[model samples]
Target: MEEGKPISNIDDELRQILAEFMVEVIKLEELVEVGRKFLVRFQQALEFLRRPSIYESSDLVKSIAKANETKRVNAYVQAGCLNAYDSTLSVGQLNTSLSDLHDCVTKSKSIIDELKNLMDKAGNALCMTSDDQLETEIQASEAIGSEKLDGVGCASYMAVIYSMVKQDYVMQEKIVSSLSFKSSSGELESYCLMWSLRPFINDDIIRQALKQVR
Candidate 1:
């Protein structure tokens, strides 16, 4: 009976750890969705700032375009239509968008930290169980399908996702920070495209993560 008690305890610990891991996976999925929304908002702001009228009306844009006579003709002609173009609205929108993006970055950082902690805990738990036992327990837990993960596979999967998300957020921060009155229409277009494409994030991994939650 005494020897069996250790086995029972290990089983209980495994079950509890797997349960907690699944909950964290769900949280990660939700956090990723929030990031997606932030990206959409950022893209919209970029699009608005990129409009020909808004872009050409900026005093800074005019100054830069002046150095290139070819661009100056188009920019000045557009600026002429709105002789009293006030940049206050554009500036305000830019400030608000940047502030919101900063908030998103903070939240993303928090989520990533939590994921790291969870991964560590999972790693420690992995030490208590053998490969075969861990695989069996993971399959029994049914949080993620047998084909999806075995042993520390889920933890590694989440780590990969967290890494990608962290990189994506960093990229977004750079793009948003770089935007200014001096940004050319072409630069703005590229920024918007990059945000939408999210080259750092993989759709397959995202799908796999989503399946874990369900």
Candidate 2:
């Protein structure tokens, strides 16, 4: 920003609001779709396992548990929060659900932070492309930056059933195969693949998956 030039013009301010609003709308719609996935997954888990989570010795757990135990998972504790993973099933499953929720939360934070950086370019008399164009670009930029929350949350949630709590070979494979859980880009690819698969993942599951994400 120039010393004499203003930090932002009225147009820039309006465009920023519009851009963020559009992003929120797209996010909400995607969330509604993703929410369904959790329901389906939880139901499947309920039917298959006949249990929510397998008991494990907290002593044998990884360092993540020690760290995570301190930070409260924020999504399911609220009223009317129908987390697919947070069903009244098992304590073990709840942990996995929390992880799933956290995965989406982390991805959302990344995208929102990226948007903040992108918005930084819009400062000081920045001329925004029309809303249509801006929307497309924002989505494009989001895809480039995000694209993983959907998959990671879903895949990892299932993994919790096997890898985290249950250690059930059959269910673990089922979860992996169900989601085709390959993530070439590690975390980044994880979020994208999940996002791409959001429509098919079930609504409740999607919502639970997105619990941790902002």
Candidate 3:
């Protein structure tokens, strides 16, 4: 996660998954379509998991007990909002289902965070490209230095670059296949980093980063 950023955005791995859908200049409609599909799929999966998560018990209790114990001791533990877990558990108070709901809500919230991040990226892509005065505003707001370009402008450029890549059928399929559970989070982080760079870095630099990842 970015410093001071509370939610998990797309990590590199998920960005790579997104790259397959990108082109040098992706249409806004296409971006929205892809995002909608992902959102729907995530919602479906969450729904599928929700029932078992609320109705089932044995395993969830053990996990939550261990997790809470870990959180209690480790001040630095990176975790989701306690309120999400707390509210779900509070409703079921005396029941084991409380733990189950906690686990389910936690996971679902993370997925929702990703969806929010995706929408941000899509919005960034549009704002950076369509707005004429955005650069001036950004330039005026920040000190005139290297860091000036490292904000939304940079992320916008990265989004454009990903869209520009001429898709290779075989390579794209392979890239998608490589994203197993073990590497998914990392890929998401990578995608986020690549696209989240300062806009001044230019296309060649972003392309090189993509090449190395490939």
* C-alpha lDDT of all candidate models, in order: 0.58, 0.36, 0.38
TM-score winner = 1
Question: What is the lDDT, from 0 to 100, of the residue 170 in candidate 1?
Answer: 77
Model 1 misplacement above 4 A:
1-79, 83-86, 128-148
Span of ten consecutive residues with least summed lDDT in model 3: 165-174
Query: For model 3, how does the per-residue alpha-carbon lDDT over 105-175 read when each residue is reduced to its tens digit?
Result: 34434443453355346445333444333334433323333332333444443444433332221222233
Look at candidate 3 and tell me the lDDT of residue 15: 44
Worst 10 residues of 1 by lDDT: 129-138
Local error of candidate 1 at residue 46 (angstroms): 7.4
**True lDDT of residue 3, candidate 2:** 54
- Give lDDT tens digits, candidate 2, residues 56-120: 32343334444455434233222222344544444355345435644544444454444444343
Question: How would you encode candidate 1's per-residue C-alpha lDDT over 90-165 as one tens digit per residue?
Answer: 5565567667666766776676677667656655655633334333343343455534444355545545655676
